[model samples]
Target: MKPIEVKNLKKQFKTTEAVKGINFSINQSETLALLGPNGCGKTTTIGMLLGLITPTSGNIFINEEELNYKDHQFLNIMNFASPYVELPKKLTVLENLKVYGRMYLIKNFKEKIDQLIEDLNLKPFLNKRTGELSSGQKNRVSLAKSLINDPKILLLDEPTASLDPDTGDYVRSYLEKYKKENDISILLASHNMDEVTRLSDYVLMMKEGQIIDHGKAKDLIDKHGRENLEQVFLKLVRQKNEH
Candidate 1:
């Protein structure tokens, strides 16, 4: 069974339908990207998968079992990281990691935290208050907390946002190495076309709460007679506006 599967999943807020019967899946060790213009329901879909938002209809399956939003065991194996979600700002970096590690009930928590510190180069500000860290520093800490459980399914929203080129490349390369070394499935929502091209195995292009087009990134580029993913994205979005 796929690590994650969504069948006609949908969410409605008041009279607005934020997600309109979307269907997709992320297989073992594969990365699937949700590409869309702003306000196209990417975050809403992620929220449903994370069980933070109850779905209006349809179902989500994890490891062949229908998701039981109340099951802590299922939640234990899944984790998410987004710059938009903030940890307790008053807490220090180390304190934040400790809190999340405890929340996940990780065994050997000290060792796990230490490893993440080393991996993410977080030692410099480990004792600094999370609210005081630079954006890039906070981003690394967010990533560290997400991996505290060594999750099998990871949801990343703009994982490389607000980083210098060198730091951003490091985070991408680290994700590649980490996924290879561990059993993980990733769902990525990113506006960085180059990042998407380098990282995702498949792409789903969404617009107006619907998937407008999808394929392997290169295939999508070729299908639209474009040179790269950014060009293809522009073509699809612009064409829709012209309609």
Candidate 2:
């Protein structure tokens, strides 16, 4: 079954249409990449799916149930992670995880926290204030917090944006293992083409508020006659202003 379905999705600001009639579906156990340049509406689309924003017109279905901003029953089944969004700066890593675990009403909060701390290698910084951590450390904590609830749908924006190569690779490997072991579905929004190509089974390319192209990752690369996903991405976006 598809974990997410979006039809005729649209969002508009006072003078600009941020998202325009985009349609897509993300299947269970699949990783889908939403790729685009700065103003292409990837964030807006993600916000709507997470119930953070109301779409001007659209339909979003998650796990076969329609999502309503006013009544979100499946909020417990979903979680989001973004470096741009931070956990409470004053809270320690463990504290933030504990609060989220309580919010999710996890049955064995301590056990879950313990497992995450070990798996993410977060034990050393567990008691440190979130704001005091380096960028890489904060990213790790953010990821741990996102997984505190054991969500089925994980929405990640630039999951490896600022980390050193080794740490970034570790994060990617962890996500790969997590998804394979748990059958989780991930929606990843990123500018890192290598990361996207490595993790995503399907690719959606958006430009100026609309999806200009989409297909399996390999198919998109081949169709654009590009050496890699990054080249394919540039070809599509550069064409936006030409025509």
Candidate 3:
């Protein structure tokens, strides 16, 4: 079975429906990109996956265990990273990781933290409070914390947003390498077309709370007669709008 699965998942907030019965899954060692414009239900769908926002109707299965607000066990083996989410402002990088490590009941805490520090090159500000670090540095730290549990499943939203090209490239390459070595399944939601093309094994394009298209990145681009993902995204959005 795939590590992550969603079946006819949906969510509604009062009078509005944010997600219209979408279905998808991420396999072991696979990366699925959720692509769409702003307010296309990407965030809402992710929120449901994380169990932060209750789904009006649907089922989420992580490692074959159904997930809901009351079932917190799924969290032990899953994690998420997003530029919008920040580590404790007053906690040092090491402190933040240590907290997460303890929560995840990680064995060999020191050894694990040391290895992650080395892997992410976080020694420069290991003891510095998170708020003191620059965006790139914070992003790396967030990524490090997300892996403290050695999760088999990861959810990412604009993970490299607002970073410089070098930093962005570093994150993309690191994710690629990490996924290869650990066989981690990732669901990435990002507006950056280039990043999606580089990382995603499959793509699901959403609009108006529904998946309008889904396929390999190259196949979608070719199918739409677009030069690249960005153009395809534009064309899809426009076409959906015209309907």
Residue 44 shift from truth in candidate 2, angstroms: 0.4
Q: Give the TM-score of candidate 3.
A: 0.98
Tens digit per residue, CA lDDT, model 3, 1-243: 788888998888898889999999888899999999998999999998888999989898888778858968888888999999999999999999999889889999889999999999999999999999999999999999999889899999999999999999999999999999998999999999999999999999999789999999999999999899999999999996787
Q: After superposition, how far is residue 176 of candidate 3 from its true place, in Å?
A: 0.4
Q: Predict model 3's lDDT versus the native.
A: 0.93
TM-scores, each model vs. reference:
0.97, 0.98, 0.98
Global lDDT of each candidate:
0.93, 0.93, 0.93
Model 2, TM vs. native: 0.98
What is candidate 1's local distance difference test score?
0.93
Which lDDT tens digits does candidate 2 get at residues 78-145? 99999999999999998999998998899999999999999889988899999999888898888888
The Cα error of candidate 3 at residue 67, in Å, is 1.8
The lDDT of model 2 is 0.93
